[model samples]
Target: MNKKRMLVSLVTGAILGVFCIVGASIRSGGEASTSLLFALWYNRIIMGLVIGLNISKKDLPSIIIRGAFLGLVVSFAYYASTGFTDIVSFLAGIIYGIIIEYVNFRVNK
Candidate 1:
């Protein structure tokens, strides 16, 4: 990826990481587990990387397909690592991909 794209991914991942931390803290009543926090950061970073790498200045359909596929791959890896299946996470991944792509599109433009 280009330097600009990398920078965008990093920034987006960091923003998502912060959101994950805050969400986890709230969900756990301000006592989130270290592992949970770590997972959140890791997942967001992966998603950002995948979205940044796959998306391009292309047609909307192609962009959507690429983003959705990459998102599924990342989400699958996460679920496999944790030895659990979460429908929410799976769906979230897809949504995250679209959101990331949209953000990149807006930023790049």
Candidate 2:
């Protein structure tokens, strides 16, 4: 339970969540529903929190895999909620997961 790692991850998630919202709006021609925007933002935050709390191998490979796995799992909730229609977002979740973990690793190094 490294507080620094947790805080970093949470901040990363929050930042990335904003990006997700912006991307969603652009993709939807600024017509994306409010709920959808909030969900995307919230999902990243949850992903960050989960990744922050998870204790994975120190190696980069392990971190990447763990991040991707956690991303897929956490993103699946939103994907399923959308009836599995938003494949891009689901995939982005995996990438964001990797990014989050990599950032954590580098920053804490």
Candidate 3:
């Protein structure tokens, strides 16, 4: 594994995670519960990190597949822990995964 690539992924994931939490906080007008807020941040960070760690190429289809899978896994875990599931979270994770992979592609290119 490329250490530089992994580093890039880590930073990218962290930034994306922060943005996800911030956006949610804004959208909810700070009304979101502590548990929900934590969950959102946790999900995004883990998803981003996973994508960054695993994504090794620039192929769109591959990126989409990996992202979708990672998102599903994370979302499922959250559901198992909280007994809550939502399509939005699953979709968001996939989207974030794609974006992270694309960014990595661009950077590495």
Candidate 4:
């Protein structure tokens, strides 16, 4: 695995995780449970790890697809855990995945 890619992805995850928390708080009007918030944050972290560890084709198209796929798969866990009620977050996960991979590609290139 590429350490640079991993590091970039992880950092991206951590940053996005914070954003996820903020978004959740706003969406729930600060009424979201702590556990739910934590899960949402951790979900992004896991997504990052998965994306970072993924050793796939280096081309841009391949990277974007892989990122989207990984994000969708990883985010599904959290989405499923919530009984599929948070469609917004589930969709955001796919976007975040693409962002993470695109950032990694740019930074590591």
Candidate 5:
């Protein structure tokens, strides 16, 4: 990806991470959350959407498959960087990407 797109992906991921942190804080009765799983879940969806923007309609399906894989890899790396080891975090990232895409399609349709 180009620098601009990479920047967008990074920023989007940061925004999503902020939301997940906020969500976790609320879920934890306003206590701050220092959870890597939440961060992984957020980054993957944002990365998927970033990659999706570069895919054409004819290649969308295959591209999405690759995008999901990339998303998982990115999330896993972030998790490792943050000292996370749960495999569930990677799975959650994949599920979140599919769910988010499905919801976006449903709404736009």
Candidate 6:
């Protein structure tokens, strides 16, 4: 949680966001781009690793429960972005959240 680490994470995350947007847009026609895959993969893997590393061993169950809720929240969070243009994207968030959270829980345990 140091300022330097936080800054690095923030910058990386923003960059990834850009890649996601670009990748998803171009995805309308062709096979998915490597850059887009890299962005999403990096975010999920690293973020999950970070969360797993920080979770308390004894509170694993509670932590997992919270993570589940977070996934649900993320699904809901996409409503604004996909509400008008792509309901599938919003629905995918729910699945993404679950998969990401499950991986985090497994790694952390």
The Cα local distance difference test for each model comes to 0.71, 0.92, 0.69, 0.92, 0.52, 0.46
Tens-digit lDDT track of model 3 for 1-109 = 7666677766776777677777767777888678887887777777666766673866778766776677677666655654564445556666676676777777887
Query: What tens-digit string does per-residue lDDT give for candidate 2 at 48-103?
Result: 99999987457999999998999999999999998999888899999999999999
> Model 6 TM-score?
0.42
Give the residue spans of candidate 3 off by over 4 A. 79-82
Predict model 6's lDDT versus the native: 0.46
- Please say which candidate is ahead in lDDT: 3 or 4: 4
TM-score for all models, in order of appearance: 0.77, 0.96, 0.75, 0.95, 0.48, 0.42
lDDT of 6 by residue, 9-85 (tens): 34443444454555566665656566644544454334433433343333556655655554445435434533445
Error of 2 at 19 (Å): 1.0
Q: Give per-residue CA lDDT, model 5, range 1-109, as digits (tens).
A: 3444444445555555566555556655775445543654456546645554552323346545754665676666655765675445556555444444433333333
Worst 10 residues of 5 by lDDT: 100-109
| Every model: Cα RMSD to truth | 2.3, 0.9, 2.4, 1.0, 5.6, 7.0
Which ranges in model 4 have alpha carbons more than 4 Å from their true place?
none
Model 1, span 1-109: residue lDDT tens: 6667767866786686677667767767888678877886789788887676653665667667766777787777766765765455566667666667767777787
lDDT of 2 at 26: 92
Angstrom error at residue 1, model 6: 8.5
Sorted on lDDT, highest at the top, how do the candidates line up? 4, 2, 1, 3, 5, 6
